[model samples]
Target chain A: MSALLEVEGLVKHYHVRGGGGLFGAPVVLKAVDGVSFAIPAGRTLGLVGESGCGKSTTARLVLGTLARDDGQVMFDGEPVGSVRDARWRSQRRAMQMVYQDPLSALDRRLTVGKQVMEPALVHGLGAAAERHEKALSIMDAVGLSSRFFDRYPHELSGGQRQRVVLARALILSPKLLVCDEPISALDVSIQAQVINLLVDLQEKFSLTYLFISHDLKVVRQVAHEVAVMYLGRVVERGDPEALFHAPAHPYTQALVGAIPTPRTRGRARAALQGDPPSPINTPPGCSFHPRCPRAEARCRSEAPLLRPLDDGRFAACHFPVLSTPAREAA
Target chain B: MTVPLIELKDLTVDFPVGGNWVRALHGVSLTIRRGEALGLVGESGSGKSVTWLAATKLLPAKARIDGEVLLDGKPIQGLTRDQMAGVRGKRVALIFQDPTSSLNPVHRVGTQIAESVRLHRGFDAAAARAEAKRLLDRVHIPSAARRLDDYPHELSGGTNQRVMIAMALAGEPDLLVADEPTTALDVTIQAQILDLLAEMRRETGMALVLISHDLGIVADITDRVAVMYAGRIVEEAPVDALFDDPRHPYTQGLLAALPDVAGPRRRLTAIPGQVPNPAALPPGCAFAPRCPAAISGCVTAIPSLDAVAADRRTACFRAGHATPWEIAA
Candidate 1:
């Protein structure tokens, strides 16, 4: 499958305030610094990171909602800077997004059926009767009853509202779906239902996905491949099973270890000493060196670029872990 | 092993909404032993938070509470407002979910913690500040004294949570009620905070009543677990047994819906309905509408928690013989 969406050397920076007044020195926070990735058709690539690591910014950039300081976002083998171009406009129907908070994403004044039909109407897909029929079908597909067609947002539960939001996104039948923490705001039982629905929808439609979330467990369950982001860079990328079982980078190692598992009790963990450094005025070398457990002298001055390993995994650390032994291999 | 730290019998809390009363808790009874962590697991609007809040006398003015809240077998129901205030800060401390909103934005974190200490313990300003720093140090906040001077806005979310925990501990309360304490934090910080809570529980022997929506989190630190649905405890059991063999239909549904942390790709089984609204709850078992094993009989009557096994309680009519546990592979 050819790449449906490719983000090449993407860079996004925000000019933030310093301690002093307007005359004080200006500070730049590199929210998404040279982050690169690609999503092929019918595949799910999970972007996993803590909050403030620029994962959301990268999503915004891919969705063309944010202006990049420097970089390229190629949609359908074409750049995406000026979306008004006919090529971009035609390809726009091929992409859609499902936001995390359905309460904020949906318009309260509109009915569920109207919300789902908006995309169909925007693309001039069909007539009013046909669009209404399609909206009801979409709602049913997402597990929303037809009774909710006239209900407002306040009348529905969080799960039902999210399903309405999902129905709206799927109405266009986009090839690529950008899900930004779509299940985080949901209850656990509801979360499982939504995730299962997404999986089923993906299988039915053969949709590619850029799944952005901070939940490692959820990512492991759904993602075909995974990318670990830190301080606005992809620190590691590999198959979900391999990376989660025995992560390569120390930061990944710390992250996987820090997760509280129900199977075991009170396992020892290498607690990160301090919080991540400020995005503004990042360290000279590795942006993570300040909080890295295995930082060396060279790490202080040299940033490591992502390099492919023997097993087709990519890691951006000078000292990647030795290959997992037979016993530890998942 | 001896007298439980906190006990509630026939606890009921009702909120006045327009003119009618919305029952948040319905005749719920529970106990927390000293140094024990009791996990209260439920979906949203399940009344897990309301139960504990009423036990600690922290409910808002609109709530009318009825029950016997026994702290070491001492009834605190009829205590005056001043006496209840004394019970709230000194005897039972609360650590809220959102640390950002819980702490005052303008005050220094140390001063906020010191204020709690001063309000309950009556320490002088200097001594309270010193105690506040010590509490922060105990919660593993680095450079506690210097960091205490920083305002809430200047601290990170995780640090602010640590400061909240420090404030909760400043009064040396016998019971700590942490309501979704780590929900707003990242996973790494969440792990650190859980570790801190575990360590504090061991050292101080303070009974902890933890309210959260995550089953895995409650399973990690809690000794026993209570599953709440709509406003009642549907199932209560030892941690291992609850996971190994959940009896109630709702409990089984929750377990089946949870993604197995260690497994290949599989479709999760989900219960097919939304949680019933608290305002207009169903007449019978609240979970009957969503329970997979719900029979015709279940919809006609509310089930009381019955002893299914040693120290295990389940409220479903078809609990033990009706619902069989399935471990996700």
Candidate 2:
């Protein structure tokens, strides 16, 4: 299958005045620097990272909510432009975003049905009757009943509110969905419900997803392929099973080992020490070296580029946990 | 067994909301033995935190609390505000999910820890400061002495949590209640915090009450586990037993809902529907509305917690014959 979305060398930086008096030279904070990836049609690519690791920024950049400093984002074989551009406005009908908090994403004053119908109305897809019909059908698809149609967002439960958000995102019949921590704010049971809903919806709609989350377990369940990001860089990318079972990057290994598994009781696993360095003044060489357990002297001064392995995985590491020759053979 | 360190019997807490009462806790009974770690697992609004708050007399004045709270077989329910204050930090230390907000951001971390040490240990400034440094060192904060001078904001979330641990330890309390302590941290940082807590518990022999929504976390840290739903604990058992043979339908559904990292991927059997509002809870079992194994009779009468096996309790009409458990078997 061909790639539905292709991102190349995406870079986004913020400028803040500091280091001197009132009007000092601005320091550039590279929120997302030289990030690149692609998502095939009707597949999910999970982005796993810590809070300050630019996952959300990448989502915004893809959705055209935030302009990129450099790089290209091509969707459906067409170049995506600024949000205000006429072509981009029309192109946005095929893309939609779902955030971590549904309450914040939804408007309090409007009923869920109205909010869901608003997208269809804004895009001028159909008549009023047709829009209402489309909204209710989409709501039913997401498991929201008719009783909740007129209820405001506050009246709904967290899981129900999330369903309303999903209904709104699907009302326009978008082909690509950018979900940023879509289930993080929910209870474990409710999170599972939403995740299952997403999976069901993906199958029914044949949707492509850029799933960004910090929960590796949930990501593993949903994503066919996974990318591990650290300080505005994709350190590792591969199939979820292989990447999780035998992670090549030290950072990925630490992340996979850190998850508290119920089956492994009192198992001793290496935990990464220290906090991720500030993106404002990221480390000289590898950003993960400060917290990496197997940091060599060479890792301190030289940045490793993401290199491809024989197993169709990519990792940016000088000394991978797995031997290079064996991994290549596999 | 030698008068458990802390025991709560038939504890009920209610709060007034717009002239109506919200039943936050419904006759919660639990025991924490000395040097034992008990995990309380539940969703939000499940009264897991309220149970601890009411046990420690930390609830607001508007809350009407009824039931017995005993500390070493001594009644502590009717204690005066000052008396409760005396029991709070010196005997039982409580750490919240967000350490940054719990700490005084403006004050130096060392001074904050020293203040607690002085209040509980009756030490002078110099002695308290010395003891505070020792506590920080115990939590494994790097450059302990220098870090003592840093403010809460200067330190990372993991470091701030470490400082919170140090402050909690300054009182040298016999029992420590950590409520979602690592929820706000990163995965790797969460592991470090969990390991540190385990190490500290081993060294001091302090009884621990770990409250979290993550089953994996609770399973890893606690010796026993309690599953709460809608202000009531539906199941209680040894950690291994609970994970291996959960009798309650709610517990079984929860365990099955969790996606295993090392297992085959399949559709999660998520429990349907949301938790009922406390004010408008159904007459019978709170989980009946969402329980897959719920029978018709489950809607009319509340199921009291019954002993299902040795050291295991379950509150479900179909405890042994639940469909989910049968599938697991």
Cα deviation of A168 in candidate 1 (Å)?
Answer: 1.4
Question: lDDT tens digits, residues A152-229, model 1?
Answer: 988888988889888988899888889999999999888888898889889988898999999888888789889999
Q: Specify the highest-TM-score model's number.
A: 2
Every model's DockQ: 0.55, 0.57
Question: Per-residue lDDT for B224-304 in model 1, tens only?
Answer: 999999989989998888887888878788877777445455677777778888898887898877766778988899999
Error of 1 at B234 (Å): 1.2
**TM-score for the first chain of model 1?**
0.95
Task: Name every residue pair that clashes in candidate 1.
Answer: none
lDDT of 2 by residue, B1-329 (tens): 49899999999999999998888999999999999999999999999999999999888889999999999999996788898888989899999999999999899999999999999999999999999999999999988999889899889999999998988888889999999999999999999999999999999999999999999899888999999999999999999999988889999888878876666667787877888999999879999888777789999999999898879999988998846633632
- Candidate 2 lands at a TM-score of 0.97
Model 2 misplaced regions, further than 4 Å? A17-25, A323-330, B325-329
Candidate 2, residue A130: how far the Cα is off, in Å: 0.8
- Model 1 RMSD vs true structure: 2.0
RMSD of each: 2.0, 2.4
* Distance from true location, Cα of B6 in model 1, Å: 1.0
